[model samples]
Target: MHRSKGIVIGFWVVTALLCLQMGFTAYAQLSMPEVAEAIAQLGFPHYFRKELAWAKLLGVVLLLAPVPARLKEWAYAGFAYTLVSALIAHLAMGHGPESWIYAVVTGVLWGLSYFFWRRLQAPSVGLRPATA
Candidate 1:
């Protein structure tokens, strides 16, 4: 029971961290001039920034709300994909290896959150088999 509680707490902590990162990212994407300039420098259309910001906000909500499990799973998958793509984009833009840190850190957070979430859904490790 203690272990299960630990896992639940760990899951929420990691999920909160991921949500915080995504929330800030979405806000920056929507409102920051620097973010717009960076996206534009990457050859993306000006409208893509707003679109991605909205998508990220929605994804964060899906992860946090009492939504269906399948939807939550998609949110996790979407975040994973977004981070990986960001890493690739940075590399493609000729950014040095150091520029990958933000994406890498966020990716790890996402991974841990997803891992704990899956573990929480499994049968408790402390449970014992019933005897006849």
Candidate 2:
């Protein structure tokens, strides 16, 4: 069966939202004092903030752009890894479960976006015409 236009639009919408979220996160990490303080409290080096911000920004671009399929796959994987690691880090630091809610939500969004992306990539299967 042919893929529905609605599905494609939905995929794009989710991907766009994910991009916006990541962009905002990267910006906050790079410039927000509170975020820097939290990072320090977590025992991460000051320079890690900048590195993570840049990496997240790059991931957002890779997800949104019409890049190679492999690159897009890597972007999805990267976001998944980032979110999971964030949750783990929060838990490791003895932060309350509530502290990891953002990571959980983002992880769900990433999974949905990746599912739709893979669905869109799949070729439609239909019966072929019979030959004489």
**Candidate 1 per-residue lDDT over residues 1-132, each given as its tens digit:** 335788889999999999999999999999999989988988889999898888899999998899989999999988988899889999899988687788899999999999998887776664786778
Cα RMSD (angstroms) for every candidate in the order listed: 2.0, 1.9
- Report the Cα lDDT for residue 49, model 1: 88
Best by lDDT: 1
Candidate 1 versus truth, CA RMSD in Å, comes to 2.0
Candidate lDDT scores, in order, read: 0.89, 0.88
Question: What is the number of residue pairs that collide in model 2?
Answer: 0
Give each model a TM-score: 0.89, 0.90
